[model samples]
Target: MFRVSLLFLILGFTCLSCKSEDKNNVGTTEENIDALLQARYTKLLNYDVDSTAFPRSYSPEKKQIKQVPSKDWTSGFFAGNLWQIYKLTGDSRFKQRAKQWTAFLEKEKFNGRTHDMGFKVFCSFGNGLSVEDNQNFKDVIVKSAKTLSTRFNENIGSIRSWDFGKDRWQFPVIIDNMMNLELLFEATKISGDSSFHKIAVKHANTTLKNHFRPDGSTWHVLDYDTISGQVRGRVTHQGINDDSSWARGQGWAINGYTMAYRYTKDKKYLDRATATADYFIHHKNLPEDGIPYWDFSHPDIPNVSRDVSAGAIVASGLVELYKYTKNDTYLNYSKKVVNSLKTEHYILPKDLEVPFILDHSFGDWSKRHEMDEPIVYGDYYFLQTLLRLKEID
Candidate 1:
């Protein structure tokens, strides 16, 4: 009997040890990721890049880094990634590098030809402002918001999204515009301009009404009749079809509305965010690891590529939503995504000297461009998600 009791006690201690390791595993994973980022980004900073260009994506086959000009929508994400690393590690090396890269985007504040002012300016300058109170960053942000406000049409109660597709669309308003409202909302707080705030709210209200379906999924593009101020057609610019749910578009909806709720304290925005978040987290097609395919409605399920960018964006959004609601579901799923992304399947090889950290992100899946690659915005949001997780820990 005494021997039996000893064996049971030993088993109990082993179980406790297993539980302890499991509890500490998240921190260990995050530390590993931080070490990886330090090594990879150090190489990136050392690599010679043009003053006019920013790292955009990596081509593994060609072993080439894709660089784009400041006018590119993804131009700010690299700078934002550097700033995020600085925020995560308190490394002044990253902060200085971030400043240099961010400077390249200052001209984009005045370029209002496209609706990506928030993507081009806020991600770089806004992140810089969050790190340090630089007057120049504030000025850039306020001006960028003004430039973005030009795209907003009072008749449509929304912002026009693309300029190149004028022949295909009249007064096109994409669901992705929801992500741009942050710049406007922040402009109000910085410049004491209620005009910016009013425009953001109007855009949000119009998007909330027109973009989402009853199932919480959003159509990618809504073309409006300029004179009638009515949605002329619902279409998909990236998804498998007009009816399919593009994973990243859903992520944009979840993140954007949560941010809107943060600025406005409107429960409608909160409700919309929650609905979309729940739809994403509980979707039948979402992989067990918490990563999702390029489109949830893609018929080719397991055969499709996963979008680490979407996973990172949604993970960051879920962390924010968890803070607001204290919902364990949100926190747990965010943690799951972070854990999945830090693994070998999604993480870039350290020996691969690319500017990006994560891999297998789907960019423009319909055109088969940048498919299953390391995109700069993916790294940015992955880093952002890590920072968010660290804050609560």
Candidate 2:
């Protein structure tokens, strides 16, 4: 299942052949990706979707579109992807559609049960705020940050990542939680409350101290002892095993710490970002095209599925890291990812009726779900990387 079906492969080839003979005459690779996005999302806007449902991924086996309720961690990504496209292309249609989709997620600002406030609120409302000045958007962001802060235990110095699996994990924190700090940092900037910033810094510092191994690879989850304020267990919920590196977790660390550095000007955060970025790009198991296997230490190795979502996330993070370090290595690696992603091998076939723009994103390996599917978050970060590349170009 790692390979696209022969039918889709043929469709992709035909789609590629239909393009203009001169690639430069059409536009830059980034611009072309934007154009493809414009076409695909315009088609998606035409679909009659359920008001309460948000697109999650395309199930190639059942040939059904997977959707989730607004509270789902991925609900905001579709709107965020639309907002990013609008920002990149200045297309008002995308902006209008983005606003409509983003409106459905407003209720999530008060849903504090999960630590994905930034992934939900920030990616949707935060990107909306960046594209246009809306006071309501700013208020939602601040409120969401406050809601997220409720999960932070002062003793643990980290936000609780999962409310489920209580029988297995007591006060568990995942590396993905690091990414939600952007909401806290931005809330402090908007509301002038340093409490949010302080909590974010403490969480980042704690993660720095405990989450990483000597090789710069990260463990996916850490369970903390609330009474003693010490890490009780280090494990992986999504990797090959407890000791392997999950590809997307490393991407989250790079992205999270780079944003932390941007807010605090702390060299430690930057250094952590650099170390993880180096580990990701230079890992012996990484493919030449810059995409990584779902788990770097998987026994299957070259036979494993590639996670385009991870590549897209890391590329966008490196784009930001490059802005700070002025290091071409970071930029070049990002460019390689972007270039590989824009090719027909990764892009959704033109004749495919799905809403996603790219394919081959592996989502939870432990459950064997969403393997080699076109996921909304993959397209979200793919667009983000495109916009970031355009910004720095």
Estimate every model's Cα lDDT from 0 to 1. Answer: 0.84, 0.86
* Stretches of model 1 off by over 4 angstroms after superposition: 1-34
lDDT of 1 by residue, 1-393 (tens): 001111110010000011112221333344444544455666555545456768899888887888888999999998898898778767687788889999989988889898988888889999999988899999999999999999999999998998877788898888888898999999999999999999999999999999999998999999999999998999988999999999999999999999999999999999999999999999999999888999999998989999999998999999999989999999999888877776555666656656777888999966878999999988888888888888898
Please name the candidate that would achieve the greatest lDDT relative to the true structure: 2
What does candidate 2's lDDT look like per residue over 259-292, in tens digits? 9999999999999999999999999999988899
User: What RMSD value applies to candidate 2?
Assistant: 5.6
Report lDDT (Cα) of residue 68, candidate 1. Answer: 88
Each prediction's RMSD over C-alphas, in Å, is 9.4, 5.6
Under the 3 Å rule for N, CA and C atoms, how many clashes does model 2 have? 0
